[model samples]
Target chain A: MQGLAHQLIAGIATGGIYASVALALVMIYQSTHHLNFAQGEMATFSTYIALTLIQAGLPYWVAFLATLVISFGIGVFIERIMLRPMQNASVLANVGVFIGLLLVFRNAMGWIFDYTIKAFPTPFDTGTPLFGGLVSGHELGSTAVTLVVLGLVYVFFRFTKLGLGMRAAAFNASSSRLVGIRVGWMLALGWGLAAAIGAIAGIMIAPVVFLEPNMMLGILLYAFAGALLGGIDNPGGAVLGGFLVGIIENLGGAYLVGTELKLTLALGIIICVLLVRPTGLFGRVVQSRV
Target chain B: MDAGRDRIGTGIALPAAGAAERSAARPLRLLGLLGLVAVAAVLPPLFASSYQLFQLTLALIFAIAILGLNIVTGFNGQISLGHGAFYAVGAYATAIMMSHFDLPWWETLPVSALICAAFGFGIGFPALRLGGLYLALTTFSLAVAVPQILKYKGVEDWTGGVQGVFISKPDAPEGLGLDADQFLYLVVLAFAVAIFLLAHNLLHSRIGRAMRAIRDHSIAAEAMGMDIARIKTRTFALSAGITGLAGALSAIAIEFVAPDSFSVELSITLFVGLVVGGVGSIVGPLFGGVFAVFVPNLAESISRAAPGVIYGVILIFFLYLLPQGFAGFPQRIRALLRRRPEG
Candidate 1:
């Protein structure tokens, strides 16, 4: 019972990271109707940038902010340069471009940062457990950070004028453009915001997973499962789905399949959700006109 | 006839070949194919070194695999980023059969094909519900999970876990007057010729038209009384079986099978090969296979990370500039030539 509780808490902590990544995925899917297959790699690149800044003697928080800004710019740049031209291309072309980006970012990280795994320092590290030993200090701190980020995102989308415009553009680009929404720019902004969110997820998870080029692959799979489970198009549902996936992964790894098959477990979850309830728990049914 | 003569006087032929021209070209095309096959069967074994023969064998194997991918993704419009999983299954099946059951390498090919086809058929069921992006996502996850599944404890006895399974290379038969590498090359070439011929026939048949129709517009295809689901599922099975056969050949050629050998990267490479070779082009996968086999070595010679960077850049650029890939290059040339006369 005690072991299960510990696993549950750990799962929640990791789940927070997955939730953030899933949220980023949903943001892109909602806006562009295309999943950024490179999201995890891009986030990994941002985390590496943060590491470089910190290694160069910048404070942790400052490095974090700088990384976010850089990642945002990259997101916008990629949208304007690579994706905008590809908007009207075939599905294979679009997928090819995304896969290309994934390869570039992932390999670039290895080329620039090297493939050796490095310990990432946590600002919240306290060498002690918290909440009656239910979670470690870093885990608690990271979870809190994730919640704060999620809350801010919620506020932005729900209350801000720019957020409303972005939503309008995503919902119906032609109509939004007629209303002078600058739908193109709104789409760019969505990409930037998603990139920024991915950076946060990467930075938060780095300490636990360690900083490495391939570190995000498994997490990305889990995030995919979470996003699919929550509803690919629903941000809130994706967040909830992330937490659920994390818990399920943990409990299942411990009690059912064991750790070796955890990634496979993620695959199974994704396939099941896609097959049984593809719209997910919170997503709307989308109909294509013939 | 006067206009045709005048156009030829400008050193540029018309965009479409006349029926008479096509008929005149048919025998030449057949002769060219026969000559090419003869060259493939004869030149490498006779002139090339053993190492070169091995590399050529690898190219043929990848060509077969890329062709398999092309069948579904190119012809049927289903994007599978996980075909490597099928390849791995095929390779493992062959490995286990040869290493455990002591089956001849040729005998294991059919078993591997059947197993991979069943797997593809099962996967195709879920695929029926998912659209392009979702299917890509699902297949990509499958690719990512394959290595882990191969390493799982339950399958470790058969899979050999991290150590992997290995089988000895087959020797040349008595009185063949051939080395092992030469014999293997011929065997692989024969299989490649057979598979490519089958694929060509399949793609030209009524079923092939239905496959393309579905790819172009599913609803229209269905309205034409084509059974979309059946065609799709069968296409998936056919594709997987072809790719799996390549995997079996690879096992024989390489004489090794490890979990790590069939990583998600292999799938990506095969997809890259498909695109570069020209999707939906019967002869394109040959170029794709050669590119898959040779390009990495060229890239890696530059740097350890060069392969990925090169693949990424080439993929993006090719999509932008050469969407039809190398197979379309000749058509592009003809189009340009025709445009010159107009200008």
Candidate 2:
């Protein structure tokens, strides 16, 4: 019973991180209806930037803030420069470009940072357990960070004028334009916000996984499953889905399929969820017009 | 050449080639294409070293795989980022049969093809519910999970775990008395040509038109009495079957199969091949195969450690400059030339 308690805590902590990434995915999907295959790589690249800043003697929080800003700019620039021209291209062409971005970000990280795994610094002292030994300090710290980011994102979308414009654009671009929204800028802003969110996820995950070029590959798969589970188009559902996936993955890896088949377990969940509820648990049914 | 002349004259008079002209020119164009293939088939043996022949064989093998990808993705408009899993299954099917059952390498092709088709069909059921991006994600998950599944302890006995399985290269038949490299090249060429021709015919059939209609507008196609689900699943099966056959050939060519060999990167490479060669074109996969085999060597020559970055740059450049891919380059040139005459 004690062991199970520890695993559940650990799963929730990791699920919090997955929730952050899944929310980023949902943000882009909501705006563009395209799943950014490069989302994980972009996050990894931001985390690496943070690593370089820390190595160069900046404080951890300072590096984290700077990384977030730079990542946002990078995301917006990618939208304005690369993806804008492809806005009217075929789905295949757009997918090709996404894959291109993924290759560039991932291999560029490998080339610039080298492939050797490195230890990431935790903001909290991780030597001691927290919450009566159920969670480590790092786990508690990271989950708090993830929750804070999620809260801010919700508030931003719910209250801000720019957020409303972005939502308007995503729901209907021409309608938004008719209502005097700058749809193009709204799309760019969406990318920037999603990138910032992804950076936070990467930073939180780095300390646990140890930073490396391929660190996010498995986590990204989980995030995909989570996003699909909750609803690829619904932020709230995706967040819930992420937490559920993390717990399911932990328990499934521990008791059922074993750790060796953990990734396969993710695949199984994605297929099942997709087959059973294509709109996801919380998503709206998409209507196709003739 | 005569067809070109006829079309050029048509620009000055009629809109384009009429049926009579098309009929007259069809046999000539077919002969020309065949003649090119004949030259390609015969020349490598005459001048190249054995190692070069082996490289060519690998290229042909990749061409076959890319063509398979083209069937579902290019023609049928389904995006699969996990065809690598099918390739791996096919290779393993051959590897298990050859090593455990002591089956002849040539005899394992059908078994491998059948197994991969079955897996594709199983995957297709779930795919029937998913659309473009969702299907891509599901397939991507499959690609990411494949290596771990192959390395699972339960299958370690057959999979050889991390060390992977290796088989000896098939020898030349006794009557042929050819070297190993020569024999393998001929075998791959025969398969490549046969499959290419088969895909060509498949894409031009009534079913092919239906696939394209679905791609253009699925609702309209459905309203037009097309069975969208059936066409898609069957296309997926065919695509997997063709790629699996290629995998069997690739296993024979490389003489080894490992989980690492079929990582998500392999799927990306095949996707890159399809894009760089030109999607939705019959000849595109042939060029794609060449790109898949040679570009890495080119990248390696430029930088020892960062071939992937180089590949990424080249891919971006292709997307930016030649979005129609190399296969469409000739038509772009022709269009330009035709406009020049008018100007």
Candidate 3:
């Protein structure tokens, strides 16, 4: 029982990170209908920036906030410069560009930061165990940070006028244009927000995974499984799905396939969800007229 | 058949060659082809070292792999970021057959092709339901997971685990009066020629028309009574089989198979080749293969990070500026020349 509880706590902590990244994915898919294949790489770049900032002695929270802003600007810049021209292009073109960005970001990070893995500093104290050793201090603190970010995002979308305008633009670009919303800017904002959220996820998970160019690849896969599971289009459902996938990954890794096959387990979940319930647990069936 | 041709004309119509012009060019075209073949056959042995021959053989192998990718992504409109998975499967199948079963290397190709085709068919079934982005996502995950799966303990005996499997390289026949490197080069060239011809024939056939029809517009094709699911699944199988054959060839050429060699990077490299060579063009894979094999070495010579940087920049630039790739360059030039005279 104790072991199961420990696993569950650990899973939730990791799942919280996945949930954040999944939300970021959903945000982009909601607007552009294009999966940002470079999302993971972008987040990794942001985390590296955070590491650089801290190393230069900018306090933790200050560095974190600055990284988020810089990441947002980078996201918007990429959309405006690279993706905007390909808006009317084929699926292959869009995918090809995303892949290009992925390679550029991954290799650029390797070049700049070097491939050696570095230990990331966590804001939370690592010396203490919380809740009778069920969870570590970093796990608890990171989960709290993730939840706060998720809540802020939910509130922004639910309450803010800018968020409402972004939603309207995504839901119907033509209609939103008639109603005087800048549809193009909304898409860029969506990219920025997604990038920022991804930054949070990257930073939160960095303590556990360590900081490296390839750190987010497996987590990205897990996040994909989560987003797909909750429905690619549903933000709330994706978050729930992300947490569920985290729990499943932890338990499955522990009891079923062992640690070596955890990635395979994530792949299986993605395929199964896509095959059995592609719209996901909470997704609406989208219809198109020929 | 005429109607199908007309439909394809509406899709990506090449400038129609008049019968008289075609006849006039036929012998010249054949002579050119023969000249090219003769050069391919003799140039490596006469002017190049054994190492150069090996590199040329690897380039031919990559061309085969890129051609397979083009069949699905370029012609059939299915984005497979995981063709490396098929390539890996093909390699393993060949390795296991040669090392475990003590089978001759030539015999392993067909078995590798069959296994990869079946694997492709299986993956294709689910693909029938998934659209572009979803399929890309699924395949990407498959690519990411493949290395891990190869290292799993369950299949370690057959796979040889992380250390990987190796087989002895085949030598030339005694009567051929050729060394091992030259023989392997010729053997690979022969296979490359045969496969390229087969692909050319396949893409120009009725089934090829059907595949293109589906790619251009699935709904219209379905209305025309085409079995969308079956054609797609079979196309996937065919594509996978071709790539797997390339993998088998690569295994023989390199004399080894390791999980690390078939990383997602290989799939991306093949994709880069397809884009650079020109998608949906019969001759493009040759250019793509050369780019795939040679460009990285060129980039690496500059710096450690140069390859990925070069590949990324070139990929984006080509997508934006030369979407038709190198294979389409001649037609593009012709169009430009004709337009300049008119303007």
Candidate 4:
């Protein structure tokens, strides 16, 4: 029973991070219909920047804020420079470009920061029993922040004019353009927001685990599973899908299998789900244009 | 009267009439392809240095694997990120069969391919519709999960886990005066050429046209009377089968097959090669295979500051600057050199 609760708690915490990342992935998929293969790598690079700043004796909050702004700018720049130019290209070419970006960011990080694992300090209280020492409050704090981020995204997409414009652009770019909405800016905005979200995810995740050039590879997989499981189009679906995956993975690892086979089992489940429910758990069934 | 040569000239219009004309005009296309094969056939003797020959050998084997990727992602328009798992499956099966059952090399090759094809068929049953990110995730998970599952405790006898198992030397005939490097390259070359030609034919065949159609627009293709699901699933299996053959040969060449050798990194390399070498073209995989083999080697030699970083950077640059890939370089270069080139 104790193990079950522990696994549940851990799953939710990790799942929060996955959901947060999945939220960004969902946003990008909605706006561009192209998956940003470099999302994790971008997050990783920004997180490293934050780590470098914090290590230089800057206050944690200041560094965090600075990192957010810089990440936003970087995202916008990437959109303008890389994606925008390839926007009207063929699907394969666009995908190839992003895959290229993934390589660039990953390699840049490896070259600049070094590939060896390094510890990044967390803003939340560390080495202290914040939650009466029963469980690590760090994870709890992470979940709280993820929830807050999710809420902000919800509010942004639901109520704001910019959000409305972005949504319109996402649904149909040509129609959005006809309505005088700047579909181009909306895409840039979406990319920028996604980048910021990924940055926050990276900073939050780094302290919980060791930081390396490929640190996000595993999480990216989990988030990919989450986005696909939840229905790639819906933000809320991504969150739900993420938690579901986390819980299943943790519980499976604890009770049915050892840690080694946990991910493999999760993969099996995803494949099975795909076979049975191609539209995913939350995705709307899309009819082919037959 | 029926037994006569019967002036059988009473034929209907051939669907592939244009194909014959295209092939005749592009005689150099076949020549260029043969030129490549001749390069491989002569490599062992020309490059007596084992190191360089081994690299060529590895590249040719990987060409087979990359060719598999091209069929799915390049031709069929499905992105698979877990092919390394299939490669590993073939490798482990070969290693185990040769060491334990003492299976002959000839026997293990087909067995390895069948096992991998089975895995691919199994994965493709559900994953064909995932598309883009979902497909990427499913395959990525398979790639990551395979190694971990194999690394688990109970599989030690078959897998050797961290220690890894090595295979027996290949049974090369005595008359073939080729050294191990030369011998292995020749063996791999034979299958690689056969597979390449098979894929070439399949790509241009009726089934190939159906796959490309399905990839471009499944709905329209289905409306056009193509079975989308069947084509997609079969394409995945066919692709995996070729990759399995590569894995089997690679197992022999290196004489060692382990989980580490078949990491997601190798799969990424395969993808990078496909994209940069030009995906849909028959020659693209060959170009990609060579790039995958040579670029990293060149990078490591030029600088040791994280060779993969260099490879990744170059891959991204190529994706951005040259999406048509190296195979399209002649046209691109000609276009650049002159304002236009006559077709």
Candidate 5:
């Protein structure tokens, strides 16, 4: 019972992180209908930026705030500069653009810093356990932060004027434009919001994982699988999905196979999900208009 | 050589041999292309050093693989991220056949190509129902799994595990005045040219038209009586077969076969090359092939780690600035020049 309890708790902690990242992905995907293949990589870059600032002797909170602002700008700039040009391109070409940005973002990160692995400092001190258990404060802190972010996103989408405009533009650009909404700004704003959310997730998760150029590739896969499983179009579902995937993966490795096969197992689950339900557990079946 | 001259069928731009050039001019154009191919086929043997001979030879073999990728992704508009797996299949097929059964080079290469094509078709058949990202994920998973299958302890005795197979060079025919490296390069160059010529001619066939049509609009093509599933499977087979052929030649050139060589990194770079070179044009594969040769050579000139970083950076830069690729550079410059005179 204790071993199973430990497994479930560990899974929940990891799942919390995955859910946070996946929710950001869900936001972008919901608006654009295109997967930002560079989302995790972009997050990694933001975290690295924060780490660099903090390393240069800035306070953690200040550095975090500054990085968040920069990340917002970066996201908007990406939509305007890179994506705007390839607006009507074929699917292959559009995907190519995302891949191109991914490369640029990751390579720039490598170029800027030493390109070596660095340990990010956690907000919580290293001495204390969370709940008379072996789990650390950092994990608990991450889950709590993720919940707070999710709640904020829910409130923004549910209650705010700007958020409603963003959703309107996403639902139908033509109608949104006709309705006097600034559709273009809405798109850019969507990217900015997603990037800011992603940046927070990045900073939160960096302390748990090592910071490197290729660090996001693995996490991106997990987040993607989680997002898809949770229903990519639903932000809430995406969060729920990430937590479920994380827990299942953690417990599966602990009980059945082992750690080395975690990726293969994750992929297997994704394939199974794809086979059974292409729209995922919570997604609506979108009708193609072409 | 001008694309305009070749476009004799009005704005139709269909893949068949142009109606206007169906006479003596057509044969002459074939001769010119063949002549260029002939020179390329012979040049590797003329190089004195084995290193130059080896790199160019590997490039020739890789050209075949890239060309296959070109046809599938560039022309057919089906994105494949698992080409290196097909290459691995071909290499292991050839190596296992040669080492275990004492098969000669002549027999091994063709058989390897066939088996890979068949295997490719098999993988493609089951997965043909999928679309877009799903297809890509399936292929990526396959690429990751194949090497593991090769390295599995159950088949280690046959597949050589992680150490892989060390192949002996084939004996030369009597008094050909050819060293083994030079000989292998020449043999590979012949098949590569054959592939290029066939692919070139193929783009002029009904199948080629079907491929382009599918790329442009699959639903419309299906309405127009193009069998998407059959042709798509065939595209996978042909692409996989060419990649496999390249793999066989690569195995001979390296005289070694290991799972490590055909990593996901190799797949990424190969796809990057295709994108950076231009996807749909005939010159695209050639441009990608040149980039393939130059990037690593340039990397060797610089530091070792810089290659991946540099390659990624260059690919991204070109993708943002020139989506069409290096082949499109001249046209872009010409457009700039045309505007500058008036400006």
Candidate 6:
């Protein structure tokens, strides 16, 4: 029973990270209707930049804030420079470009930072026990960080005019344009926010997984499963799905399939969810018109 | 079919008809295609070195894989970023059959093809529900997870875990004067031509038209009484079968099978090949095959550490300059020349 509790706690901690990345994926999907395959790579690059700042003697919190801002800018820049031109192109071409972006970011990180795994510093200290030893200090702190980010995103979308404009643009670009909203800028903003969120996920995850060029590949897959399981369109569902996936992954790894097949477990969940519920648990069913 | 509806539906009636008329003066295009095949078959044996023959064989194998990808993705408009998983399945099937059962390499091809087709059929059921980005994600997940699955402890008996399994190269018949590499190259070439011809025939058939109709408008195709689900599932199977054949050929040519060989990078390479070669054209996969076989080596030669970066840059450059791909170059040039004369 204690072991199971420990597994759940660990799963929730990891799931928080997955939720953040899943939310980022959902954000990009919301606007472009195209999944950014490079989202994971982009987050890794953002984390590298944060590491550079920390290595330059800046405080951890300062580096974190700087990384978020820089990641947002990079996302917007990518949208303006690479994606905007291909807006009217075929879906295959668009997807091809996204793959290209993934390669670029992944290889660029290896080129700049090298493929050596580096230890990332956690803001949370390891001295204290949390939740009667069920959760580590870092896990607790990371989950708290993830929730705070999620809450802030919720507030922004619910209360801010820019967020509302972005939502309107994503919901109906033509109608949003008719209403004088800058639809293109809204998309860029969406990409930026998504990048920022992905950066946080990466930053939080790196300490646990250790930082490397390919650190986020497995996490990204889990997040993909989560996003799909929760309904890729529903942000709240995605978050819930992320935690659920995390719990399942942990419990399955512990009791079911073992650790070697954990990635396959994620894949299996994705296939099962897709087969059973295409609209996802939270997504509205869309009808194809003749 | 109504000519007007064909025009509206296909958007290629006039150009295709004109091309057919042009073909009438040059005998049949089929004859020309066969002649090209004959040249491909005969020339390498006469002039190419062993190393060159090996490269050509690898390129042909890639062509088969890309053609398979083109079936479901290019023709049916289903994006599969996980064809490499099918390819891996095919390779492993061949490897295990040959290594474990001591089965003849020739016999494993059909078995591999059947296994991969089954996989595709199973995947297609889920794919019926997931569309567009969701499907791509699921497939991408498959690609990422496949290597790990292959390395799992339960499968280690057959898979050999990380070390992988290697097979002996098949030798030429005693009557033939050719060596193993040359024989393998010829074998791959024969398979390539046969598969290419098969794809060509399939794409030009009535079923091909239905597949394209579904791709262009699934709802409309369904309204017209086409069973969209059956067609798509079958297309997936066919595509996987062909790709599996390519993987079988690759295993023979390389004489090895490993989890590392069938990475997500392989899937990406095939996809890049499809896009760069042109999506829908019959010969596009041939171009894609050449790109897949040669580009990474070229990138590595330029910079070993950052070959992926180079590949990415070149990919973006091509996407920017030639959105329609290398297969569209001839058409683009013709359009340019026509415009120049008019101007």
On TM-score, the candidate that comes out on top is 3
**What does candidate 2's lDDT look like per residue over A1-290, in tens digits?**
88788888889999998888899889888888889889999999999999999999999999999999999999999999989998888788778888888888888887788889999988998887777788899988998999999999999889999888988999999999999999999999899998999999999999999999888888889999899899989999999999999999988878799999989998999989878888889988887765
- DockQ of all models, two decimals each: 0.78, 0.73, 0.79, 0.62, 0.27, 0.75
Question: What is the C-alpha lDDT profile of model 1 across A246-283, one tens digit per residue?
Answer: 99999999999999999999999988997799888898
Candidate 1: which pairs clash? none
Off by over 4 Å in 6: A288-290, B1-31
Model 1: lDDT of residue B299: 90
Model 6 C-alpha lDDT versus the unseen true structure: 0.88
What does candidate 6's lDDT look like per residue over A1-290, in tens digits? 98999999999999999999999999989888888899999999999999999999999999999999999999999999999999998777788888999889998898889889999999897788877888898999999999999999999999999989999999999999999999999999999999999999999999999999889999999999999889988889999899999999999999999999999999999888877887779988866543
Q: For model 1, what TM-score does chain A reach? A: 0.98
lDDT assessment of candidate 3? 0.90
The TM-scores of all predictions, comma-separated, are 0.96, 0.96, 0.97, 0.91, 0.88, 0.96
Residue-by-residue lDDT tens digits, candidate 4, B29-144? 67887998897689565765878777888888888999998899888888887788888888888889999899888899999999888889888877775555566667767886
Q: What is the TM-score of chain B alone in each candidate?
A: 0.93, 0.93, 0.94, 0.88, 0.89, 0.93
lDDT of 4 by residue, A239-274 (tens): 898888788777887888877776676687677668
lDDT of 3 by residue, B27-133 (tens): 99778878998899998877889988899999999999999999988888888888999999999999999999999989999999999999998877786666557
Clashes of each: 0, 0, 0, 1, 0, 0
For each prediction in turn, the share of the native Cα contacts (below 8 Å between chains A and B) that it retains comes to: 0.72, 0.70, 0.68, 0.68, 0.15, 0.70
User: Clashing residue pairs, candidate 4?
Assistant: A100-B316
Candidates ranked by lDDT, best first? 3, 1, 6, 2, 4, 5
Q: In model 3, what lDDT does residue B71 have?
A: 94
lDDT tens digits, residue span B59-163, model 1:
999999999999999988988889999999999999999998999988999999999999988877776556557778888999999999999889889999998
* Candidate 3 regions with alpha-carbon error over 4 angstroms: B1-20
Model 6: colliding residue pairs: none
TM-score of 1: 0.96
Q: Distance (Å) between predicted and true CA of B250, model 3? A: 0.7
